[model samples]
Target: MQETNDADTTPTHVETAADLDARIDAADRLLVEFYTDGCGACAAMEPILGVVARETGVPVVTVNPRDDPALIDEYRIESVPTLLLFEDGDPVRRLADGFVGAERVIDFLA
Candidate 1:
């Protein structure tokens, strides 16, 4: 008596810089999905990112580095699909330039 694969599987939209401060400070693992407006890979990875974010109950905010030059400089992000993992506001790992999956996300932290 269980249900999985709900039809309403929209990736929760995360759109802000300040929103991250609290979560980044509290979370052991933070996945920041950095992307631009017209990135094909970024578009493709949306749902998968959402699923993982929700499953983990972590703050997965999308940072448009191009829009915010400071972010680009802050994280040194040079790719469309970059996932920056932070531990207590300190960056522990970074996965970049592609549509990496959920298992891969877990693997990065491990």
Candidate 2:
């Protein structure tokens, strides 16, 4: 995969929840964004997540809960644009307020 510092050039799309699990398990550290279609804040997080991935070298993946209804109840995702930080297949932190900037995201990863 090509790695880029610019958010516009990053490859951060995760197709399915199963793919998401494999990606997270494969990476030492990962940031997964749970989003919903037509969510303004969720849309806004795309580039920011890319920036986080580029700067921190932490692979970022995105999943729409609507794709899999079970994820909503499993993860307790009450809102759109919820961010989950994972370390070796285990979730470490969660950020689910709204549009979070790159700085806060970096700090959250730390």
Each prediction's TM-score against the native? 0.75, 0.87
For residues 26-92, write the lDDT of model 2, one tens digit per residue. Answer: 8787788999889999999998987778787787888887887777887789998899988989998
Residue lDDT tens for model 1, 66-95: 665777778888887988888778988889
Count of backbone collisions in candidate 1: 0
Measured with C-alpha atoms, the lDDT of residue 71 in candidate 2 is 77
Candidate 1: residue 6 Cα off by (Å)? 14
Give RMSD to native, each candidate: 4.4, 3.4
> Candidate 2's error at 15, in angstroms?
3.6
Cα distance off (Å), candidate 2, residue 9: 7.8
Clash totals in order: 0, 0
Candidate 2 lDDT score relative to the true structure? 0.82
- Every candidate's lDDT: 0.69, 0.82
